[model samples]
Target chain A: MAHLGLRRFPPPLMVLLFLATAAGKEEYGGGSGGLRFRREGGTFKVLQVADMHFGDGRSTPCEDVLPAQQRGCSDLNTTAFLYRVLRAEDPDLVVFTGDNIYGADSSDAAKSMDAAIAPAIAMKLPWAAVLGNHDQEGTLSRESVMRHLVGMKNSLSGLNPEGIKIDGYGNYNLEVGGVEGTLLANKSVLNLYFLDSGDYSTVWWIPGYGWIKASQQAWFRQTSSDLQKRYTTEEPTQKEPAPGLVYFHIPVPEFGSFTASSFTGVKQEGISSPSINSGFFTTMLESGDVKAAFIGHDHINDFCGKLSGIQLCYDGGFGYHAYGKAGWSWRARVVSVQLEKAESGEWRGVKSIKTWKRLDDQHLTTIDSEVLWNRGSNEPQPI
Target chain B: MAHLGLRRFPPPLMVLLFLATAAGKEEYGGGSGGLRFRREGGTFKVLQVADMHFGDGRSTPCEDVLPAQQRGCSDLNTTAFLYRVLRAEDPDLVVFTGDNIYGADSSDAAKSMDAAIAPAIAMKLPWAAVLGNHDQEGTLSRESVMRHLVGMKNSLSGLNPEGIKIDGYGNYNLEVGGVEGTLLANKSVLNLYFLDSGDYSTVWWIPGYGWIKASQQAWFRQTSSDLQKRYTTEEPTQKEPAPGLVYFHIPVPEFGSFTASSFTGVKQEGISSPSINSGFFTTMLESGDVKAAFIGHDHINDFCGKLSGIQLCYDGGFGYHAYGKAGWSWRARVVSVQLEKAESGEWRGVKSIKTWKRLDDQHLTTIDSEVLWNRGSNEPQPI
Candidate 1:
């Protein structure tokens, strides 16, 4: 559980090499809007807050806290940690990779869920989420949890994908459009997919934790295909599917394939993956557009590893209310997708996808920074 | 590891209904002629011999044998076991799924490999093979082992897929042709795939047993696609891609997703999968052609479970030199693909795929008989 994931190790030096200046964000004018970057200097940043495990509106006691930090420690500490990261990062989008609340600790799941989502709403930032295995244990059903999130302010997550029958709620995709007024503005420069990995086993045969099922996979793949076709139709010059990212709770069993030494960051415990693999990793891999996937559920383990062509990453345990080792700091992951500029200096598509983690420690130190996928990385293409 | 695969559990009852009085395999006069079944009563039977772990000739001491059985046991016992199964099953095809020779135990890997294939050679059956993790631990480079296998009599194993570069050797496919003189004679009614699931980790980033690589997966998908197109072209009225079966040495890590109670077979050991999942299961699922994948690496774990649409199964250990519990008899698996006759009583295509295992005890106990897939099973189609 404590072993870090793959590929983040290569970045400390690379990020230092590219201390590129940044411009403010741009307003992309398209239905696939809500995210954009300037041709000259801007980049789209996404902050992944994993396993917040918020309960009871900042009053619940945090687990795995140091004695000295426990004077007034509670869910407030988790809130404070998130505020610090959000203030420091000012990300274009926030992604909560599940366990938004510790349902068992809360008196009312819906009320506790509001507390969990309050920061993103208060910040007026567009955010999206998928539920963890524990999100349904209290007052509300899993479907209710997702519906509530979708109805929240500035929320981009869908209750489910449109026009398709699939497993689980909150199975949807959001398109991050390119620069405004450009021919590519209609194109989804970056695509993000969110899927609920379910709360528990539904059948006696494939028992253990819930996993992404086949119907959900079929939906994801169809959505991916449609997105790719749309991107190509919008910009015929584009060479591949728009760079995509996936978010889900509960790592697929494939995450356990790596040894402690194989990944970056730290793995403190075994990967608490579902008993059945469900093949989503393969599904995403085949999709070809997905460059990286962010997951939560193994609270103490935060690492990134490149498997096949895609990077399997953990956002690290980002909540004090979640169980983590006392010595490990609660942390959130960040990705900055830099857009490429054309010869005439107009914004093109994604130049690179870079990632790093910021710990909740006093300095708010950025650790495990690395380039996840670059245009020139020669990532595998679909047949 | 003891649990049997998915779909197989329901087969015992269904297979009883079909009782499928199998006809002797037919001689389809086409390039894909090695395997066939007549419209009247034919069925294609394939015997899976896993982890033979043969050493020099017939004089090696077998491990995990009952004391009385050990007194006169040697490699001969394993040879005898194969002969017994072959005689009883009279399979049209014999598939040796890796670990064909115990390189560490053998004085010469090449000579020991000869002994391993002698049964099939003497029996003069059409055979194919893919190597296991232990096959290259001796003198021969993996490439050389496959080269030798390909040059043998009645061998269908390839040095590698022609015209495409990929990871590992012996990646190839064999097509079972339709019955004699039918319009579908050239059509590959039953496609069989064989891939060498490498001997060990070749890269520092992925450690443990060698898993399928991205390049290999790419090749497999391409091959699967090509095969599907050919089948459709050959039989214009066919609704789905032809049924396919893949054979390899090591089980993909997804195999561990099942609980002991979930599968029908006896779980005697843990699934020894590679450190990384190379996306082949998803690839096959996407292909919409593959029905079941047969693998061998974990010597004692014999089970089959369907994931998504394809069934992942292990051929129980068929060699005595391989380690096993004393009472658990070494066994071989059999697949009988029955073909359907047309309304005019001519061969149509594969009607159903059924499987079972035969333990190497007196009476050669037949057990775990089940139908893996049928045209009416409504296995998931490609997205």
Candidate 2:
């Protein structure tokens, strides 16, 4: 059997093996570290496929396929969508925001999951995922799914053996290293927090949604504060803490907090309902580390609005098995952040970040292009 | 034509008329003021009939009536339910937490509203209300509904000429004074904030739920702070700021911010979906005045739990026309706050608060009785 976890191979050997094999992959930012960004100043592109909801080849019908198609089942549709997006955007990293596989029978889940992620695996592209509410609804538990995902080649999922041991799974952070002259030894230029928002409620008698528990909140606060303290030191390039983005399956309650007038894109469906107010959003807002949050449960709703200062956005539907209106077109959100040099001859952090959606039909047309965050040219230097 | 408002009547004359005609009524706390409380230390009972959904007598059918009944419609059922509760509980105050009148037709909404409130009016009982999401679904807007409610015989609704004008309606506060011995003028022993969680979204497309706007949140914070400052003055009986309870139709986003294990009641269905986090709950937590909040929108799902420190509760279902399970026994929540003499021989603020639900089956039985808040004997006096 293939290795089920990163621990099977030692860290140094794994790093050496990854670097040796990653030479031909254009998507891989070839470096000594596990996951690295551009050493020279350039833009880091990320394509997010949210709410894939893929199923076994026979069980789930492909909702987005043409009438004449025969093998338009969930697995086929997911593969085609991923292949299309990969060929079109060629992102440095691909992030799957939960619901990647429709939980069918446990026996077929491994093959189904493999087929769902086959495009990325075949392309030798780096990818990561957080389990969604529906990912564990079938036979396989979330831990089992994590094992499968972590075992895949070029998978960047940091599912620690002893993560949040409560009800959820895969509560880990991934870091992208700064340039060589970025001044900080132990600091990263950007951080990505992936949280498991958990499935249905187990404590309450009535089966409904659950919130991020107190333990997770505590973990988040400690980790976030640690990151902020580590990066906010008086280093020349690090005047402020590095900006981060949070991704999870179910959108936080604050996702519903903004006005529609403030939104820049189409508000198709209203926000999908959330069961409770997990203080995760409040924690991020107070920590000031998270500049934006991207969520995927509400497939039809794709609008980004600023709530209190952080941007809350929805990645438009990317799955064919999920429910959505016809002709609405399945799309994926592409986010790119660029690095620049400051006037003081120091490498500054991400200069600007922009986001847009690419149509997944015959024509790969980009729509709703908007600048989510910009480190202005006239921004003052640290005193 | 009948009077649409009380502005036509002189204030002093109306007061005199109310005082003259308000005799022999058990519900009227007959003192010099408009609505008075018990003089000696005792419990003040409040029966909340939430989500009445009273229609214009014909358009909406009463869903809970017996099969043999002929007048099985919304208006009749609402009136009967109110009359039954009033005759059974004889509560000190009847608080209708929105959705009182289902606006079937704009022209007949006035009569429908009048019929809905006739039971309390005939009993000369003091009452108040907040608008719900469905209250103004027809031609009559929330402003018109508030106007009609304010003009009623014994109404205590504080809807002003110019309220929260941006999105919602009737952002006002009601006061429950302490025993006559408590010191301070223009001060209250307990405050009840009634907010209009507005109807549908005029901003977002697809016609889903809307959130409490920023302006309303600001209003709540300012009003709560002012009340806290006013009540925290150096009075012999008032050692601490007075306690408060907030009532609205749609719950704040923090209502979803709790775990099921943290909940204490029967988790029939999880908390009804809240669209957005308006930061109202955070404001209440920070201001340290609001002890609990009661809401009534999802008719069948009624559960109460502590999010942070504040208690978030539901009033259960009281309307027969609304959608709920068959023969599930519609109910209303009764909240009572008790005042007790402190060591200083002065009447202290609310000593203990209890809640119970009354079922509307063949017999009236109170169930799920729990003490939500209490000033324990060993508790230190507020200095």
Highest DockQ: which candidate? 1
B1-383, model 2: which lDDT tens digit per residue? 11112122354653454344444223322221243456544557788888877776655677755565436455566677778878888888888998887775324677777877788889988888888877777667778888878778888776632422333677777667665434321245667777787776552311345555444555665666666665564233356666778888887766675676776555556455434344566456645667789998878767777654567888877887776666676788888887766677766577877788888866678887887776643121121
Give lDDT per model, in order: 0.76, 0.67
CA-based DockQ, model 1 = 0.04
Q: Stretches of candidate 2 above 4 Å error?
A: A1-33, A64-74, A105-107, A160-167, A181-186, A205-207, A234-237, A344-346, A376-383, B1-383
Candidate 2 local accuracy as lDDT? 0.67
Q: Which candidate is the best by TM-score?
A: 1
lDDT of 2 by residue, A90-205 (tens): 88778888888878532467776787788888998888888887787666778998777877878877564253233367766766655543432224567777778777655332
Model 2 TM-score, all chains together: 0.49
lDDT of 1 by residue, A256-371 (tens): 77887778888878988866455677667656788999999998888998777688998888878888888789999999999887887778888899999999999999999889
Q: Residue B192's C-alpha lDDT in candidate 1?
A: 82
Model 1 residue A297 distance off true place after TM-score fit, in angstroms: 18
Lowest-sum lDDT 10-residue window in model 1 chain A: A1-10
